[model samples]
Structure formats: structure tokens, C-alpha cells
Target chain A: MALKRYRHDWLYSFCSVFSMIAFMVPMLTVLGIKDGIVGTLTRRLLENPRNREISPIGTRAFRPEFFEALITHPDAEFLVPETREISATMNLIAEGYPSFDGDLYSSAPGDPLLSETLDPQALSHQLALGEIYVSQGVAEKLGLSEGSELTGRVGRRQGARNEYGRLPLKVMGVIPRHITPKYNVFCSLDLARMTEDFRSGYAVPELGWKGKEKGSEIPVYSRFRLYSRDLDGVERLRLHLLGLGVDTLTQAAQIKLVKDLDHSFTVVFLALFVVVGGGAFASAASGSIDQVVKMRRSLAVLALLGISKLRLLVFTMSQAALTGFLAALGAEALFLALAKTLNSYFGGSMGAVEEVCSLSAFKLVAAAAIIVVFMTAASGCAYTSLADIEPSEGMRDV
Target chain B: MDPSPQKTKNGAKEASPPDPDVSDDVILNCADLVKTRKGGVGYRLLVESMTIGRGEHLALIGDSGSGKSTLLDMIAMVLKPDSAGDFSFRPIGHAKWHDLWKIWRKGAYGIFEALRRSELGYIMQTGGLLPFLNVADNITLPADLKPGFPKAEKRERFKALTATLGISHLLGKLPSAISVGERQRCAIARALIHAPSLVLADEPTASLDPPTADRVFELLLDLCRDSALVVSTHEQNRVLTGRFKVWRIDCRPGGEGQPIEARVAPLKDRAPAAALPAGRVSLAKSLSDSVH
Candidate 1:
């Protein structure tokens, strides 16, 4: 007959809101960190193909034997020759470059130096045939189409030289301009192989009696470039190659850069986790405590009215869980907004920012932990308050 | 005067005096009841040797702190008697029915077991209705707590009491929404709903206006006609003028007693006392017939 009043107390409402915020902070923080890590990893995975083509630094030369061995490694797909030189050359037809009027000669077609038209199959056959493919940049500069003839002197030729020296050659084909417009070229391995003065090879004299010997007398030198499946694999493969008396300075350097980036990511993740997780836990705990205290009188009244002590405890816990969940959502939204604003201000690509802000399994785990912590804290407070309420005392005017 | 008397065949008159050897009519008895309280350094007796019959109205009156409330609480079973004192009662055969009904009706035992049964009801100085429950719910609280009563019967009882107390209009209002007089009326209605055999009222009319208090007292007496009524009060005029037998607890020290002893004596006997009042006569006749 004595019904309980169902009116909401302002103090309790305020406390509940506070508790929710507290619980949410940690959950959101953890979620943010998890999202950021997973996002970065996913973006890296998605962009890996594009990123792999551009070496962080400049190119390094390798020996014919090294190339042969590297191509045989399990993860290595193909080997291509790349010659590096700085020059201003452009696709006059494509409209980005207008100043250059004269033709340009850089690297050969099918070379890594030429971003486009460096076909693996074509380059491998050409290396076998001792022919070179001219870069698109060279064709564009010279205003020459495919199969055009061109002449250029090889400066700083490291190997032996032939008589009547500035070599004349026929351009096999023009590469597309999107790969690289500046200093772009692809050449057969024979070009570098023929230069005997180069540290890793024999000179023109070593090519031996140029007219007397056929193409067989001119040794076909191979260049090796190593590619790895993963950065760790790269390091292990580099070590193995170095142990095998092969040169790997460039490969080792690239692996070192990747390792450094990984270490930096670790430090950043740790810092974020501590800050966010701690903040969320503190917020949830404070809010839960306040709520329990605020509802003490109501709890006492209910207890006297024949509601069991255990039921009250469960009720409070349920309230805490609900509040924690809501608060986590709010905090996550805020974090996302902040991440977006930061990304915009810094002019960073949205892909990376979005990846970092994405929620994942780790974020869910963090949110759950926050809820558990809040419920535990709330139950503790409820227990203390419940212990203090005596039925006779409750019936009296407070 | 000889206390034992025999009933006639019709049971309408006291037929003849009982033989001195035969003794059994008295169903409830109390002897040399002494209640004490710590006063400064010494203890004081609050009530001494108070007794009542099966169907008598005994009005207890005193000034504040005179232990009237304490005595009522003792009789109501709300408080335990001190180890040094003794109190006892011989329950009648129908008392078992009251006990069974109290347990069956109230699923859980009320703190005041004896007062809850024995057809005993209490009206406090201030009406204690649960604030959230309406007047009707407050009145039916006891019956609702128990089982075994048919719905129709309960409804009939509820309707009769509400109409008799002139509170039918206020049945739906919460206790807080009603006036003090109405709240008191509701409390009285609740106490009489079960037709208790004994009603203990502690300053039931203390907060009511004189007219309201008189009306409440009259209603209380009418409803409790077949039961014993004990009211502890500070109001001298209300008790002195009432038709019920009166007991005044005087705290003044007397012969062979402490300073706080209670001396209970009958009010001055009047010759040709007003014939049994309308409600009382019928109630007495029915009770007399039942006893015989």
C-alpha cells in the first residue's frame, strides 16, 4: 500500500551525469589509442605499393652476381637496373613542363630510374640482348617518339671505354610521364656492365679486343636489387646477404629507417594510452562515488520499505554501467572531433587521420574496462551506505 | 464487592452471585504492575497495578511525563517490561482466532503482536499514514498485507468504514494532500477496520480541534463498543466527562509508595447513570448473549 515515490532527485541526476563523464573518459581514451594504431597500420598496408616504389633516399648500385642472387630470394619478385642523375626534363605534350626546348637524354627505358615504361619482362630480355630502352623524359626532351635515334655522351663512365666514345643508340620506346618526369631513365644492365672503370666491374680493356671478340667476349654483368616482404624480414635478409660476402649498405640503411619509425610509434602509443586511460578511469570513479552518495537517502528509504540490500546494490551497478557506456560514447565523439580538427589544421591527409580515429577491438576492450571500474567503485560506495542504514533509524525523521 | 457473578438462562441479567468456591469468569487479569524509569539518580514507578476487563472501556489520563504514553506502549507490546516487573494476561478462547487472523492477514508479524491482534488498535498522537499512499490505501494497509479475506468482503468492510467516517470523498487523496482532521479520521478508520477487541489511543485527539476531537472520540467509542478501549491522554475535560470508566495516574508520592506511583481508581459513581447509550446498549446486549 505504501508506494515508493518515483520522482528523480536533482542531486542524483547531477551525480549520475558526472559519473558517466568519468567512466567515459578512460573508455574514449583507450578507444582513441586503439583506433589510431589500427588506423595507421591499415593505411600503411593500403598505401604500401605506392610507398615501396619511392626509396626514402637516393639509389645505390649493385653487382650483377648480387642481382642474380637477390632475384632468387623467396620474397624478391623481380630485378631492374636504375641509374640516378639530376636533370630538368619533362613531357612537353603533357603540359607541366614548358621551358625546355631541347631534347633530353637520361636513363634507359625499363630502368628503375624511369618511373614508367620500366617493364620487368622487357628489361630482362633487353639486358640479355645488350640493348637499352630510353626513358620517356629523354624522348619528351628530344621530341622523339618510340624507336627514335639519339646520341649522348656517358659522363663519369666508371668502366673501360670504347673507341670513338660518345655512344649513339636507338630508343626502344617512350615510357609514360606519370612515373617520373625529372631525371627519369631506364637502361640495360649492359650499359653499366660495359663501363669497366666502375668499381664493381672491368674496364673497356677488360671487354677485350672490341672488334676481335663477339658479344660473347663482352661479359654480361648482372645488377642485383633486394626487396623484402616486411621490414623485419628485410633486416634478416640483409644480415644473411652481408654474411654471404654480398654488399648491402643501401638495404641496411632502409631497414634502419623503418625500425626507427616503428620505435617512435611505440612511444607515441604508450603515451596516449596512459593519458587517455588514466583520465577515463578517474572521471568514472569520481562520478560513481558522487552518485552513490547522492542516492544514499533514497537507498535507505527503499531498504526500510522491504527492498533487499542486494537488489539495491544491483540497481546501483546497473545505473553505473549505463552511465559509463553513455559517457564513453560521448568521449569518443569528442575525441573524433578533436582528431579531425587537428588533421585539418595540420593539412595532413584525411586517410591517416581517419585511420587513427577509427574504433577497433582494442577500443572496445578499453571501454569495457572503464565500465567495470566504474561499477566496482559504485558498488563499493553503495555497500558502505547500505551498511549505515538501520531500519528503525530510517523510520525516524532524519 | 464480590467480583464473581452468574449469568441467567436468557443471559440478559446477572442471575445470581457465584458460589465462593467456583472461579473462572475473568479472562484477562493484571496484578501489581510496576514500571520504573531512571529519574536523575533514583528510579520512579510509572504505572502500578493497572487492570482491565474483557469488554470494558478504561480511560487513562495524566499530565505530560506522567507515564501515560509509556503505560500504553507497554500494554500494546511495543515495549518490553523491565525484568524486575511482572505482567500477564489470560487470553480468551476467541483470542486464538485473533492470533491466527493477525498472522494470516499480516503475512509478516507486526512489531506490536498483542496490539496487532487481541482486536487491539492504536491511534497515535499524530496520524502516521505513509505519505505516498492515498487515504483509502492507508486504511486498508493491514488487510492488504494479509491474505484469506475475500475481495467482496474486504470491499464491503472498506465501504462501510469510509461512509461511517465521512471520509469517502477523501479516499483517493494522498495523506499529505488531506487536512489534519481528515488524516486523523483516516487513522481512526484504519484502526477500527478489523473491528479490534481492544483499542489503545495515545493522545488521539491531541492535535484535533475541540469539536473534531469530540466527534473523533464519539466515533472511536461507537466503533469499539464490543471491545475494550484504553486511551492515555493529558486532556482532563475529555476523559472526566466521558461515560467510560476513568483511571488517573498521579505521580505524587502516597502512603507506602514512591514519588511516581500511579493510583488508578474509578471515577465518581453516579446514581441512575444515563441508561446505556444507544450504540452501547445494543453492543452490550449482543455481547451478553454471546457470553451466556
Candidate 2:
């Protein structure tokens, strides 16, 4: 029966093939790309060193009272009590100095630099103790190399201190260009502590038996970075530190902002895919079902002549499968064409690009199955209803 | 013919009184049949208390919507009364006597069942031959669906029948490609292929020209020689005399709340007066003579 019908209606057969192709190609492409992107992003995030950190900032400035409590609270890891002034500034240095490069800020404490770029004769003019890394922009301007040295001057501070006011230090290692601009200049904790503007005046002696006394004035600042193993745990700790006269930003706040952005983008991408691909498949299926309904009378005659319902169903399913297969093929061709056009337009962006259209065997098979199921199910239901119609009723129409 | 009559009488004499065996002559029996149709306005009684006998031709004459077709459908087992009275039939064989009742109860059984029973046939008003099938296939459709007889035998019968109808040349053409008269002939061929005990035709000559309609009716009467025939028609002159039992259905108000009534009467006995030379009967005279 199917053979007989197919031999007579080539147009219907071709339509079936075309509908399948249209339904499958885009569905597969979208599924594959989404899976690939999510997998790649997750892997990159998990492998990064920052993902392991409990908190990126030191605990002391985050919540002073919590830090004090933690020092005696048994769960604390390192209990060396210390205080420092934190500040942010943008600086520029001569381009040729090796130690003056922007990369100096990202390096560890022992990184080497060019002595010729710095005043090596004076210890106070050497690289500051603890790690001192300069910003990438400053490194480029200073023409800094790994071993370069240069003069480092304290910049403006919001809080006042009288201990070591407005002093200069030796240039340090240049930070790598890959580091983000926000953390471009990374000075040692000791260096930030030494600057007079960082000290709370009426400065007392440094912790120990005997130390120098500076002044009695205290500085007030509104912002600080809090670091902890548990991001939310540290925020809870932050409130305690606030009672100790320190203000801080918790990792929880930063995480919330990042999550919101990620969720918003994911939803937008999915909505766009559904609106375009879903609508196209639906329209194609609708047209195919209408054609099937139009052929109901002929099918009814066939049913009366002794074709079983199951065989008729299979015939109808074959029609849908053919349409879906063709549609999938057409969709693939369209995707390929678009890929070619895109590659021609923006191939240079990817640096030595080849073919842009990537057809994976797995994706193709999955899409084909989906197309077949969708088309077959839609047309099968319609065919079943039509097949059950009595031939007497059909003749009445005549 | 005299010896055959003596043998038939002798056979009837030998049969026991109150015989359970069905007589070969009695084919169809409808006792107190009734039919009703539901329209937008209300229910309309189409047929009431209609009965037909074996090898007997019946022409149901009535006006439009007067239930002629509905009566044919009821007798053809295509429609069942809303509340049926008793309908019984002794088909060609004893085994088929019970099967006919089963087929009648279903109202619309598969066409194969009718072919299997060989108890009833129908020539639809519009000549219902499947468009895809050629004249030959249309005539041989019943045998093809249910191969009860040998292929060669069936083929021989089909050839002979088509030749008698002068449509042998059209055997290879589809029904759609043929003229309406040829199509009607083919429909008659199809209905007679199995040699059913009863043939019910609904307006079999409706689409034919007057001459063609007369020829078609003659063919129907010829075929009715071995089977009972009930045809629905509105033509007054086509009623068969002496050979058929005429029944006219009237859809008018009657006494005691009866809205429809069937007036059955034996065809007038004009056979002796209609003796004519061989092959010399005028077409109109022959039609009127066969259908009075």
C-alpha cells in the first residue's frame, strides 16, 4: 500500500523529506553548542587557582573582631596579629625600567629585576620587602624587564598616618599583562603598612618587648577587602568585624553578582533558541498535518477496501519521516551556507580559520531521531483518526 | 419442461410435512419490518411492514423523500430499524440460513461478509464501482476478496455475463473512464457475480437515458430469474406485471396515527395477452411488460 501511494505522489514524499531536515539540523546544533560551552566554562573555572581560595583577601582587615576572636577561637590557622592601611591608586612609571613594568605587581616576593633600572646602591631604594609587583601599563611605559628596578613613591591615601610619611621604595617585579587591571599594581602588605598615611597616629610601638612610638592619631576609611575560606562565612564574620571599627566587602556579594549575570544570559539564550527553532518546526509540522487531513477521503476509501489501520498508520508515518528527513537535510544545508558566509565575514577574528560548520556524527544521529519521532507522532495521530472514519460517511460527502 | 415440472412436484410430495429443511424456492422473508430516520425536525417513519418473496421482483414506487431508498437500504441490510421487527431468510444453503441473520443484525458488515454469504447484493443509485478498479476487477471484486470458487470458473462466469450485457469490450477500462450506462451494466454484473439469493437495487437506472434505463431494467429482470429482487424507483411505467409484486409506499397521514403505509399488490396477470413474436418486443413495451 505504501509503495503504491508513494509511486503516485512524489510531491508528498518530497515534502516529508524536507520537513524532517528542517526540524533536525537547528535542534542538534543548538544542543551541541550549548553542551560544549557549558562543559568548557565549567572545566576552566574548576581548574583555576582562585576557585580553591577560601577568600582572596587576608582575614585581618575583613573583620578585625572576628580575626581576634578566631585567633583565640581554635579554628584559626595562622594567628600572627598585625595591622595595615589599605589604599588604591593609579600610577605611571618610565617605560624602560625593568622593575617599573606593570608585570611587577603580579610576581611573588623573590622575583628578580634589572638592577640598571633601579638605584641599587641604596637599600631603601631597592625593591620593597614582601612581594612588590607593578601594573602591566606601568611596565610597558617603563620598558621594564623581569630584573628591572626603579623608584616607587607612596601615592595619596584617604586615611592619615604620621609614622613614615610620603616615602619612596625600590621598584619591584613587573606584573604579567594577563592579570586584570583592577589588581594591576600589587604591593607587599609590609609596603602598604610602612607608608605613613597607613598608620593610626599616636602610633604605638610595633608588637614585641620594645618598639618605636609614633603618634596618637587614628585614621578612618570606609572600604576594605575581606578574605576567607568560606565566602558567606566571612560575610557573617564581617558584621562582627564592623563592631571592631573596620568596614569590608564580602565574597558573597561578588558571587551573587556573578551568578545573576550567568543565569540571565542562560535564560536569554534558551528563549531565543525556542522562539526561532521551535516555531519553525511547529509551522512545518502543521502544514504537513493539514496535507494529511486533505487526503483523508482517499485514505478512507483505502480503509474500506481492506487496508488495516496499522498499515495505514505506517504509511502515514513514512510520509512524516520523509518530510522530517528532507527538512533536516535542508536545515543542515542552510546552516552550512550560513556558516560559510560567517566564516568569510569574520574568519580573521579566529586567527587562521578553517571550515566554520562543524557537523558531529553524534549530533546528527540525535537530531535525526528527534525529527523522526516528532513528525511521525504528529502525523500518526492524525492518520489514526482519519483511518477510523467509516467509508459510508465518506461516500455521503460525494 | 414437462418432465422437470413432474420431477419438482414429485420432490415436493416426497418431502415430509412440517419440514425443517428450507425450500429452494423461498429465499427472503421480512415480517413486520419498520424503519425510522432522524432529521433536524424530528423522526420520520420511512418504511412500515414491508415483505418480499423469492425469485419475485418488487418495484417500490414513491415520490421524493417517500422512503423508497430507505426501504431498499433496510432490505439490503445496510440500515437497521431503531426497533426492528422479525426479519428471517433462508439463503442458498442451510449453513447460510443462520449466517444471513448475523449479517442482518450488524446493519453494516464488511463487504467481504456479503460476498461470503451470497445472500444479498446491491446496485447503488450512483453505480458504486471502486474508481481504481477496471470493469473486470469491479465485477470480480467479491470473488477476489473471498475466493469461494475456482479462479477459472469465476473468470468464465464473468466473461459470459459481460458478453451477455454487451460490455465485454469495456472489461479492461476503469469505471470512471466508461459511460454511465456501461457503469450501470458493470454494477449489475458485480451484484450478480456471486449469484446472491436476493438482490436489492436502489435507483439502479437513475442515471441512464430512457432507452438505457429500459435496457438496464430488462437486464435486472433477467438476472432476477434465479434470485429475489427489490428495486426502488419512481417511474410509473417501469413496474413489472405478472412477474413482480408491486408495493407503493405513501407518506401521508392515515388513521390511528400511522404516518406511513406500504400498499402491496400482485402485478396484474397480463402474461397470456402479451404473447409476441420472438425478438420483436418493442423496448418500451418490453420495459413496461417486465415492470408492470
Point to the candidate with the largest DockQ: 1
Query: Highest lDDT among the candidates is held by which one?
Result: 2
Tens-place lDDT digits, model 1, residues A3-113: 122123434544655555654554454545455655465455433422233121333445456556666877544355433323212122222334232223223333343
All models, DockQ values? Answer: 0.07, 0.06
**What range of 10 consecutive residues in model 2 chain A has the weakest lDDT sum?**
A107-116
Question: How far off is residue A350 in model 2, in Å?
Answer: 4.5
RMSD score of candidate 2 (Å): 13.6
**Interface RMSD, candidate 2?**
4.9
Best by TM-score: 2
Fraction of native Cα contacts reproduced by each candidate: 0.05, 0.00
lDDT of 2 by residue, A38-123 (tens): 43343333322222123223334333454446545222222222233243332334434433212122222221221212244421
TM-score of each: 0.45, 0.49
| Residue-wise C-alpha lDDT for candidate 1, range B1-292, written one tens digit per residue | 1122321221221122322332242323333344567554333444444455556677886555556666675566444444212243433335321222122223333423333433455566666565656788767755553335356766887898899889999998988788888888898877666555566777888888989998988887777666578887666566565467787655544335434344445555432323322212232243343245
Q: What is the DockQ (computed on Cα atoms) for candidate 1?
A: 0.07
lDDT of 2 by residue, B1-292 (tens): 2244643443343332323443556555543355554443332443334445567888876555666666665555545544433445666554443323234444445543444235566676667776656788778865554446568867887887898888999998877789999988988887777677778777787778989998999888987777789887766466544545777654433335443333333334334423422322343343344344
